[model samples]
Target chain A: MERTPPHPEVSAFDLQLVLEALVDPVRRSIVTQLAVTGEDRACGTFDLPVSKSTATHHFKVLREAGLIRQYYVGTSRMNALRRTDMDQAFPGLLDALTTPRAVAR
Target chain B: MERTPPHPEVSAFDLQLVLEALVDPVRRSIVTQLAVTGEDRACGTFDLPVSKSTATHHFKVLREAGLIRQYYVGTSRMNALRRTDMDQAFPGLLDALTTPRAVAR
Candidate 1:
């Protein structure tokens, strides 16, 4: 039985939590990929270096932090970057982190 | 005999290290104060909730990450945000994090 996951509200966005979620390179990669592609990606479609369970954990953290929104499209869990929520809560934050200078190194 | 501490080169500025340095609320507060005042301040001037040793540790982390530069003026340790270096390295990162939204939380 699959169910939709919970997400923090835009008003409840926490910069600390967002930073924690983005501190890990893998999670940041997930975000950077989404920002670059500007598309929702399926859980398995991301080129992550971790195991399935680990990737799931990363997605959970991003979702909980309001950085990403997750929904079930058929059997695949699709992840979308919550760019609007992020910008409203912390202006220019996503743009800063997703830019080449941020993701390059 | 006090000596100037080492800082990572601008070219060697690492996002992971910068994120780690900014993740802590206390350290982020130091950064916010700097960004708000736009002035080089003595170590004791910042209003931190941590003890002296903890505050010192925070300064060290910010300094080593190239987020801030610390120098001795007489006997006081003065701290200055390396805005130019950070701007060159990460572009809008500092401005984003030091903005009201990032610091508001």
Candidate 2:
């Protein structure tokens, strides 16, 4: 897998990267999974219907956007939502994006 | 001087486009200016230091990302923040992003 060194220019308000990173339903699903589990999960753990290549692409987008942090923990790349960074940057923006809508039965 | 017709696939939650469009400080300045003015502004009105071409490109990015609505209202194109649409999609997100932080002297 590819890794990018941190750039000082990348700040919390990099809105385009943030937006583009989260545009996919699958990525949203991943976020929800992280939130629900309340813990970081390995990149391979997500049961996405798409192929591994697509999953890798989504993870890369999220990582590049600074929404999630990925690092090698053994052979697996563990992923965790960068809640603290996001909350500090935009403060409550992530909560709005991930809130579950009430469904009427 | 190009206009894109409305597309059904264009939803407010298209996060990548939204993030990319707002990444530029000039665009954020435009949004803040729109918020401060509390009214729609013409494309030519924003006194950005950048060239007019760059301003137009920024506007196009915002428009494509569904962050702002643009329409011709005479010779100039009028622009307004799509606050309502953003609220519906990710309620309270814009407020968080645009909130003025308290500074102590």
Mark the regions of model 2 whose C-alpha exceeds 4 Å error after superposition.
A1-20, A23-29, A48-66, A71-73, A101-105, B1-20, B23-26, B49-61, B101-105
Q: How far is candidate 2 from the true structure (C-alpha RMSD, Å)?
A: 5.7
TM-scores for every candidate against the unseen true structure: 0.95, 0.64
True contacts kept of 1: 0.74
- For A4-97, candidate 2 gives per-residue lDDT tens digits of 4342223534665665565577887787788767799998899888998899889888877778888777788888888887777667767866
DockQ values, each candidate? 0.77, 0.25
List of chain A TM-scores, every candidate: 0.96, 0.83
Best by TM-score: 1
DockQ of 1: 0.77
Q: For residue A9, give model 2's deviation from the true position in Å.
A: 13
- Candidate 1 yields a Cα-based lDDT of 0.91
DockQ class, candidate 2: acceptable
